[model samples]
Target: MKLSIIILAKTDTLSLFQMTLNCIDSFYESEKNIDAEIILIESNKDYEASGFKYPDVVKVIIPSEKFNFHKFLNIGIKAAKGDYIALCNNDLLFKEHWFSEILSLGEDQNDIMSFSPVGKPKINTSNSSFEIGYKVMTHIKGWCIVVKKEIFQKIGLLDETFDFYFADNDYAMTLKSKNIKHALVYRSHVVHLEKQSVDSEVKSKNIPKELLSKYKIPKYLNDNQYSWVFNNEKNLSGFLKFHNKWGSPKLLYRKNKLADILIKGKLGYFNRFFLRLKF
Candidate 1:
């Protein structure tokens, strides 16, 4: 089955586009069985105006309005004719044989909706599996994920509810609710140049207080739910706090753990404890 790669891109980051192309080129160098088709979903006219060339890219789709990541991803998925579809951000760089590794995983497990390594932990060679308990939450970094076309048909599409964050988790949760399995293929890896599309300085100053507050862990989550959200936040905050010292990662980690236990129970404690090992 051919592999169709879809990259949701904007006009500002041409370097990121080049990096993605290089990643695809490396994939082809290692594995020749796959037919790679790229769909560049662009919302800006500057990209068209720049006249950047994607020699290997099969098609490009430019939207008239501002880009809605999830919506455009759904559009690309529908346009894909391959048996397997890969959805990724324009900033990700894949390792050679990444597609081959995903194909290997899919060969034995047809139920998998998508598969990629958990990027929270440093990418390394390790083989382990444990059920996350609450519900399997897929980060969908928009960096690297491979899914069968049928799964997309079954699950409908990414919920437009989340214009940015939580859309992937929501989609994974939806698949889990229907008993579909999601796997993590550690062997296939991608380096995510996170938030490369958006200007970090602008985002830091411009994102409203309300939006920042929205990303916080809600008070209502149960032990497992709280643990999941807390871990996700901790991962993000750990990196941010590391570089900027906005707050102490240790303090935030402990505070979140205590909050989870107080709000939920022992399950939260265990989840938090388990997460700490990775840090």
Candidate 2:
């Protein structure tokens, strides 16, 4: 099946841009047969106007109105022509045979909604081959993942309300709700320089506010269930550190509690308490 790779980006640091380009070039060299195209969703008009050049990229201009992650993805989804679409963060540098590994998974499994590697490179790779139920609550990082085009048609685009963080989890949950499978392509490795695409200044100001105010754990998820997705150690720690330092700790704590309740379930109470203790 043909694949279209969408790289979500803004005007990022020079090093990040080079890293992303290197990854794309590596993929091109290794997976020559895959009909791949790169789409760059630029948030800066000036950056877009500069006309960055890459061999296979089809540039799509996004006005710098407000940064809406889900909306940007929807735009790219509409433009994608491949049967299988890969959503990759601009901060990622991929392994040479990454596409080949993902393609191999798709060949064996037709019912998969999406597929991703088991863990982030460097942090953990021990569980690479582990296979678990698709519905098992866990954090699904969006840095690199391949999805079937039909799954998008079924679930629709990402919920724009979640401009950034929770969108990936929400998409995976949506697929799980329908019993659509997702596989872990252990053989495919992608290095995610997480958050590299975000402008440091904007991120310092906005991301905390968004997580504290705009982000809410859906009512449908129970405490334990919610904790699995939102209260995971890394997610909670990162949020606490950022918001506590820049924004209102009290408000963030309350919001975090709500997130624990809605996403994690009753077990989230302890999870939240534990996270607070660590922080």
Candidate 3:
């Protein structure tokens, strides 16, 4: 299968850029029939002259003062040259045969709209027999997703108004409206170096920290791979905007664990997560 690997590059650090590309290369190194194009959306205008470069990555420079995640992703989405599109962040690392693993589970379907490979579990459990190594979810995480190009043709590219967050959830809602199902590829997984772009933008560009208050991240997630789960936030602007448009009891509770516990008491459905998630 042909695939277009789209990665968003939004940080000032060149090492991180090269590291992400290296991970991509490793994922592709073992495969021969999988025709794929790797594309990069460089949010920094100066990336062209930054002197740090990769040999084969197709770089599109999108210089924006306030980079809109949906807008930039749409840009890469349009430029991609494969039947399948793989979207990833600049901070992610991958295991070997990542492409093959994702394709193994998704290549034949039209409705399996999205699939993500989760990393290996520290301790294996009873559910280790899951074919893809990860459990299926309603929405593939924004950090990494493999999907058919036709899905976009059906529902349209991401809405640019979302600015920084919930773009995936909004897309998931679109899928829901059409009754599409997404999945998580259990065996195909990667290590996400979490928020390399956001941290750099915050440190270098002075973007506010409160922009991430809408969701809940676990406190136990101290490792780099788990970094995407937590952020330092202290406001509600983002939260209100997000929930106002797409809030549902399930979606809200899934994002904010505290809310689920407070509202559900002993009946919160999220407790099923512990029973279901063996990894």
Candidate 4:
């Protein structure tokens, strides 16, 4: 296979199932020429037993462990036969000719190890580390990115300690440490249905039902399901694990050689102690 698209299916609700199906359908519609396979990592056993039909070509794997983002991603990557592997979300719409454009860019550059498709709402700010295009980039759209299989051999697997968040930061930092190139290919595009995976508000507020409708989320969904419900605690642990492994998030994005030196040098004793104190 040329590419393996790994999508995690967490269909605890009707809307979630529909979104996953939509995402899968969009991929089939968009990429007719590519020799690609869709690997569905179904995390929810309840959904798996629900008897919902998936596309004929999708290869489904039911993990024995709970839904940890990196854990599942690693599983899918291990099973993939493709030279290029896309770690994708269930809540995304693959645009027309997306894979063709990405493949073209990858063919042009031998050094670029990974690629992220352009999304609807672009990153708000640009810095030395964060930019979109066919250059070496420190930033990556973690929601959906295609990585060459060789990157795994060089950087090793993603830190499975991250249950929900900061794994992308860890990977980006790893790429930076190795000086391996990754880029945002604007020619390739995807629509990220952000906050659809796990929505939470530390300071709670009601989101208008009409807004939910825009994402095709049923307003009738229980209020508890709307936010602060799924994986918040696990994601918190992921935050701590990131700091424990890579130190402060601020240091990860800072615009200086010192920050890189500090991060790449490993967290000093005092820094580690302070992180524990803060956490």
Candidate 5:
């Protein structure tokens, strides 16, 4: 297939998963020329992907009862067999011709190691005019990073040592360290409902399930069905290792970034302040 998407669903409610599938089907109804396959990696057998209509979309069930972000991401990437691989979260709603934009960009710039889906920008907007290709980017939105299969061959898959946090940044730093390029795609678009896998005191304070339902953001699965709770304990421990491993300018840059978010933005949630962090 031309593009293979890897969705690591930690714990997705069946209705939410159906909504995600429906979103993809809606977008691709027009882009029929592009042969794409979605590879879903389920951390457990919470829901059956076989229930979906897209047969070409493959599903891999890894028995990670407790989700480890990097581990399942690596598992998906290793299993992917596309010219391009898109690492995704299950809570996204894609915009029109998202595939065309990314695939076309890859043709012109070959050194791109990663791309952030034209995410929930400060300005919520999307345009398909690829008039300008991309902006050189330092940070990749881990929720939606698209890279060539070969980049993995070059830089290697995620450092499992990261376990849950900063793996995307670590990979980005590795690319920067080697003088490889990455970018923010200005043209394409995908709506990342930054609700799932968050609500952690470390990253994003959990948006109440009621709030999520009110906004129609796909929600946390049933506790009896499948559920994910990010481990703050692991997140802190992982960050320290990341701080040490990619030290100096790299880690310093990350530290600065955390400082910026903690200082500049009002994420509304008080507890997850990175700048307030002692370490």
Candidate 6:
């Protein structure tokens, strides 16, 4: 089956511009013999009109709304013609055999419906190495995900409720709840340049750290990935929407251990009530 990789980029800075180009170039090298199409969802207004061009292999989609993670992905997914779809963040550098390894694992485990490349820590007891170099994980990082197109038909599009953060958490919960399998193929590694575009925005806005502390976001999570917490009031509400749906894990939890506990349901239904009151 062919693969369609959908990348989201906002080229408001030189670093983002360079990263986007590098991301597409590396994918070209990694895809090798696989049949794949690269779809770039650029969040710049009139990018084409502004005379920006990508390689002929890339089909660019400039959406009306600038930057909503789920919205941008859904737009590209609709335009995708491949049998499999990958949602990717612009801040990643694809390694050789990235797509082929995932395809191989998919062929080996037909029961597993979705997959992610490892660039972050493995969370949850559900993560177990099934193959020599790979493990199936429930708690997945949204940075890069490869999914069967049919999975969207079964589970539906990404929940538009999320403005930015916790959408990955929501997706992970949905897959686990339905007993759908999601795997992290360690063999297919990607270098995640965690901060690029969003860091520039944070600096440009000059948001004082004292003000960000009010959101109670963990210091480490205050980076570009979770920077949406300070975007606006609507985006701020996403923090609670996620907790209300799944039990609230401690925002200040020592590590991602809280996520593992919460996903396992060991905390129980009243976990959010008791835990949130304390935080």
Put down candidate 5 lDDT per residue, 1-279, tens digits, no spaces: 388888876444566666567555654663677877777776646455645333455555565546777777888887777888888877777777776777878887775656666765435355643322222232466778888888877667777787666676566556644444566776677777775645345665444545434332123322333223322444435545655665443435675565445433544133234322434
| Model 4 agreement with the true structure over 141-251: per-residue lDDT tens digits | 788889899899977888787767677867765666555667787667789888586644422344455544434232332456435322344444455566566655454
Provide the global lDDT of candidate 2 against the true structure. Answer: 0.61
Per-residue lDDT of 39-134 in model 3, one digit per residue for the tens? 877776775576766655455556465577778788889888788898888777777677687677675654466677665433336474223212
RMSD of 1: 9.6
Which candidate achieves the best TM-score against the true structure?
Answer: 4
TM-score of 2: 0.66
lDDT of 6 by residue, 1-279 (tens): 789999988876666778889988888787778888999998887666655677887888888875787988999999999989999989898888877888888888887788888774444354544322122233375888888899987678888777576777777666654446687776677878875655343333335556555665545544687665666544455666776665444443432354345546644343334333434
Q: Model 3: how far is 242 from its true place, Å?
A: 1.8
lDDT of 2 by residue, 1-279 (tens): 678888776654566557667766766776777777877776755663555554545555575567777788778888888888888777766676777777776777676568776445434447554243333223355676778898877677876655665456556545544445677666777776667666554333223435644445334333564443343333543343334332334544554455445443434334333433323
Q: Which ten residues in a row have the lowest lDDT in candidate 1?
A: 129-138
lDDT of each: 0.59, 0.61, 0.61, 0.71, 0.61, 0.71
Off by over 4 Å in 5: 49-56, 63-66, 121-139, 197-231, 248-251, 254-279
Write down the RMSD of all candidates, one decimal each. 9.6, 9.8, 8.9, 9.9, 11.7, 6.9
Q: What TM-score would each prediction reach against the true structure? A: 0.66, 0.66, 0.68, 0.74, 0.67, 0.73
Q: How many angstroms is residue 238 displaced in model 2 relative to the true structure, after the best TM-score fit?
A: 14
Clash count, one per candidate: 1, 10, 6, 0, 2, 0
Which residue pairs overlap in candidate 1's backbone?
89-142
Best by lDDT: 4
Error of 2 at 127 (Å): 12
Q: List the residue pairs that clash in candidate 2.
A: 222-265, 223-264, 223-265, 223-266, 224-264, 224-265, 226-263, 226-264, 227-263, 227-264
lDDT for model 4 comes to 0.71
List candidate 1 segments past 4 Å from native.
118-141, 199-202, 205-279
